[model samples]
Target chain A: MKFFINKENLLFAIQSVQRAVSQKSPLPILTGIKFSCEEDKLVLSATDFEISVRCAVPATVEESGSLVIPARYITEFARRLPDSIIEFEAGPDSTMAVIRYGDSEFNINGYDASEFPSFVIPEEEFSFKLDADLFKEIIKQVTFAVSTEESRPVFTGVFFEIVAGRLTIVATDTFRLALRHTAINEETPELINVIVPGKTLNELARTADPKSIVEVIIGKTHAAFITGEIQIIARLIPGKFPSYRQVIPNQFISEIKIPLKDFLESAERVALLAGENNLLVSLYIRENHVVLNMRSETGWIREEIKSEVNGDKLEISFNVRYLCDVLRSINYEQLVVRFTGPLTPALIIPEDNKDYLSILVPARLSRE
Target chain B: MKFFINKENLLFAIQSVQRAVSQKSPLPILTGIKFSCEEDKLVLSATDFEISVRCAVPATVEESGSLVIPARYITEFARRLPDSIIEFEAGPDSTMAVIRYGDSEFNINGYDASEFPSFVIPEEEFSFKLDADLFKEIIKQVTFAVSTEESRPVFTGVFFEIVAGRLTIVATDTFRLALRHTAINEETPELINVIVPGKTLNELARTADPKSIVEVIIGKTHAAFITGEIQIIARLIPGKFPSYRQVIPNQFISEIKIPLKDFLESAERVALLAGENNLLVSLYIRENHVVLNMRSETGWIREEIKSEVNGDKLEISFNVRYLCDVLRSINYEQLVVRFTGPLTPALIIPEDNKDYLSILVPARLSRE
Candidate 1:
């Protein structure tokens, strides 16, 4: 393979696909990135049997061929190279590629191209398109609640469902749940559902451009997200997702509307005294104000933030980290929190945007 | 103890002394900071036996008392507090201090101040003063070469020797050595020599202000550095430091002058191909040009840089990391490297400065 590629373009392509490169695999070939050169573009692909990524960049090709280079060396070398035209060439019979720039050259040994596992998009049963910005927002709002415990594999993935031109995403870790609904461009009479690993959604959020449109294709055993010149295909996590709707309460005994920024600041300050082993912070809601209290072996702190509170006065205890996460994720100025009782789950939603809501299970307080 | 202090002032005092606070100590009092309220100021002190720090901040003292507060809690709380007057009070017999600000309050438990270790500056045999900026610069230029091996305890400290009106600092790990000389404001008939641990010098460098004057008092077993409102006392590393002057070569067979930036960049790039086990990069000097070459199991790369070379043509190899450290520490556009032979130590110094120089031992090549 022979091609003269711009340093920035090559680096971008490598970074986009190299996230899928296996760090330590039994098959050594999976640790490399496959590089293919055509008449007008250079393609890079990497996969670890879970998620596969492909990215194409414009290049001036002299000879068309393919090679698999070690991801570790090439990534570091590309970052340190000067921002000039890079000359790359490798004979069809040779497994080593020579990269030259200015007065320096690197001859990096690689595996045979035929040994690399090729990734081909499977036949899609359904496809839908959405704004890249909306897709990123949806992932950010719900992925944080995905369970990290691998024993329950179904909870480790985010659920995606499209029904009647509206798309809904949900993620839960048994203790808390997040749900977001947005209007999608595609209309499907039947329900389309898929469970994608949380890791895939995070990578997509990082690589997707907000100005472009993203097309999602769902296959029987895999799913693909295509945006501009990049495509990410991930294996579908096979399992039945828990029913998330039944956990969200529809009624409340207390509803408190507070300024998001002030509430977040107060919670953070109170959390300082909440010992790491037991991150419990109690919220006492009154007529027009709410107070946060936390006690640890070393100290106890109390912070008060004025807000509009309604319904019966009550006190609820929760893991302060869960409250902080929801406050930081939303951009609204005010938030409404609904509480049913001390033992029931509390629902929190942005005051201006009702489509996104999160539920947190109250912690059982051992002491008053 | 009762006092009202500015948030910024309290934070600065905490940060300055917190470096000496013990993370985990058998003596529980050492894990806390001693706060002493005087008529006009509040004094904060922390010690870990090896190093002690004291800083005084102006405060409105309502009463005179003392207590030991946990460093971990107070430091984090101080950073997050808003910029306002903080009210602090504790009964003479109570072990808990109540800190109040706005509508927030923190009641932190602590130990009696009587249990904390007291640090007292000893009588100095000799003392000298220098610009804090210059002291920081000298520490940075020499501390990088200090040995980290605990077996050789003497090499883990930087040597400080002041003779007449010149101060010279030297650090070496036996493999490489860095020496710097600068003029101080004080002159004494007898030389003052001491070795300070690298860890202490690094902390001193970080806390010293550029606009202040630092007075260094050398006691028999301890050294004290006083700058503005902060004072750091460190136990001197007792041992005879190895004589460093004999390793420097006065004459050389070849002298090469190269642009510092270009030489540094080339060395870093060539070092990428040098295996981590053997960081050997060979420099081939011929007339007015130098070539950097490295060969590893995976690849080999060579880079050429134009410069002003004199004397006999030769090739020498050295660990690129050692060369890069000296190049990065000095602020000079051009550097002159003197080489006696392929195996002899190479001397590198700023082309325009004579007060700073570094020597690197050549690495023996095992194969061609």
Candidate 2:
């Protein structure tokens, strides 16, 4: 099989599909990215059972066929190939591929494409479409809270559901939880709930352009996200996601509205004295200011930031990293933090935006 | 001890001296940075036995004294402190340092200053001065060829020698060598030869400003580099340095000039197919162009680059990384390479510069 393609387009397609290729996969075929040239298009694909991605780029095809080449070699070759159209051809045995650009040529080994596993979107799956930017942003807001541990597989994914009429996504690692939803303007008659692995959402958000609309399809055990000419199909995380709403506090004794920038900088400075590996920082709320106190065996640092306060004064301690993550993800100038007590979970929200909410558990630091 | 110092100046001093603080030193005192506060200046210092750095920043001392504080905490506090002057004070036991900036304060633990070991400059040492930029540049050109293995301590250092009144520096891993020297115009009445460890030169280059002339003092076992208010004294590597000039060919049978940019780009691309650990690439020199051929069990890549050839067609193989290193380190448009058959070493030199020269030993490819 022979085809000539633009160097930039080929590299883009190879990188997009190679994201799903597992470099350390036990199966040799899983390390290969399948390349198929048909008529006027070249389709590149890779899968590791958990997730599969396929991207098709326009190319001139004098002879059309398919082969599976090592993902690492193909990416490196495309990266180093001269800035020009490249003549790529595969031998009849589908074991060797040659790439020529300018006067440079690379002959790389590959495997027969017949043995490669491919994912197919279920015909009976339910389908819905959302603006790519909206989907990517929502994923970014919630995915950071997902558990990275594999033992608790359900918490390792972001829970997706149709709550009321809006599409909602929620993630939690037991200690902290994040929930973000699209505008309630869109109506959905059918109730849909699926837990997608956080990795799949991150990969999709990283590759897909935020301008276009993305079509999403869900089945019993798999989900597919389609954007433009690229499609990503991932296995739905098994097991039931926890009911996080119950854990989030419904009432708060005190609410303080602080400038996000001021609070973020003060928190960062104070957290430096909280020791390595530990990010414990205390928040003391008063009438006109909130004090951040962090200490370890080596030192203690306290910083105060002015804010608008309501209700009784309270004090709470939390992992400073969690608060920093929430503050950095949102672009709001002001943030409202509500505290029920020193031990209970605190709720943080953007003052101008109501769609995003984060709950952080208080840490227990010994005063002794 | 108590003092008030500019936060930026103190931070710079701490950062510069902290490089010599050993994070994994068996002796706990070596991990601490010694701070001596006089009437008008505060001296901060750290040492790892192999190398020591002392830097002084202007400070107003309310009480004159000295103490040793943990390097990590001091650097961190200084980094996060406000931009204004910082009020610093040590407790009566000289074991705790307190720093206050604006409304924020940090209390850090430390050790007694009397117990900390500090290096004293020898009065009998000989001193010399050299342009910092020229010395830093010469170190950069030759240090990359130094052997990193501690087994051969001398090979892991760049030999500084006075050859025919010129300051010559040489380094080699035995397989290859790089020698760089200043113009042979400056006359040195006293002959000096010393070997400085690669790490010491690297740290000095990284921290020392290249604009000033550096004062270098050579003692029996230590060499001190004094630039501005910062001084770095390192234990010189002691052993016989191999005569590298003998290995460098004085005469060549053939010479070829190639565009550095073109040759560098082609070498990097072809080296991609040279396997993970081995970066050997063969250069086939003909009348008009040099073809780079690199191969592994999985694949092979051949790239051709045009050059002005004065030699007959010859084929030689060498580690492409060595060639790339020389090409990237020097900002030369054209480089002249002299080859004596395939087995002997090849000399690479910048067309317009006589200050740098690098030699590469040919690799024995299996096809031999």
Q: TM-score of the A chain in candidate 2?
A: 0.95
Give the least accurate 10-residue stretch of model 1 chain B, judged by summed lDDT: B269-278
Candidate 1 residues lying further than 4 Å off, grouped into runs, are A91-93, A210-212, B91-94, B274-276
Cα lDDT of all candidates, in order?
0.89, 0.85
Using lDDT as the measure, which candidate wins? 1
Cα lDDT tens digits, model 2, A17-126, are 98899879898878989989999999999998888999999999989998899988788868877788999899767789988888878888999888888669745356
> Against the true structure, what is each candidate's TM-score?
0.94, 0.91
After TM-score superposition, the amount by which residue A100's alpha carbon in candidate 1 deviates from its true location, in angstroms, is 1.5
Chain A TM-score relative to the true structure, per candidate: 0.97, 0.95
Which residue ranges in model 2 land beyond 4 Å of their true spot? A119-134, A184-186, A210-215, A274-280, B5-7, B39-42, B58-61, B82-85, B119-133, B163-165, B184-186, B210-215, B276-279
Number of backbone-clashing residue pairs for each candidate, in the order shown: 0, 0
Model 2, B246-341: lDDT tens digits are 788977767888999888888877766766666788889889888999888888888888888885688899988887777766667999999988
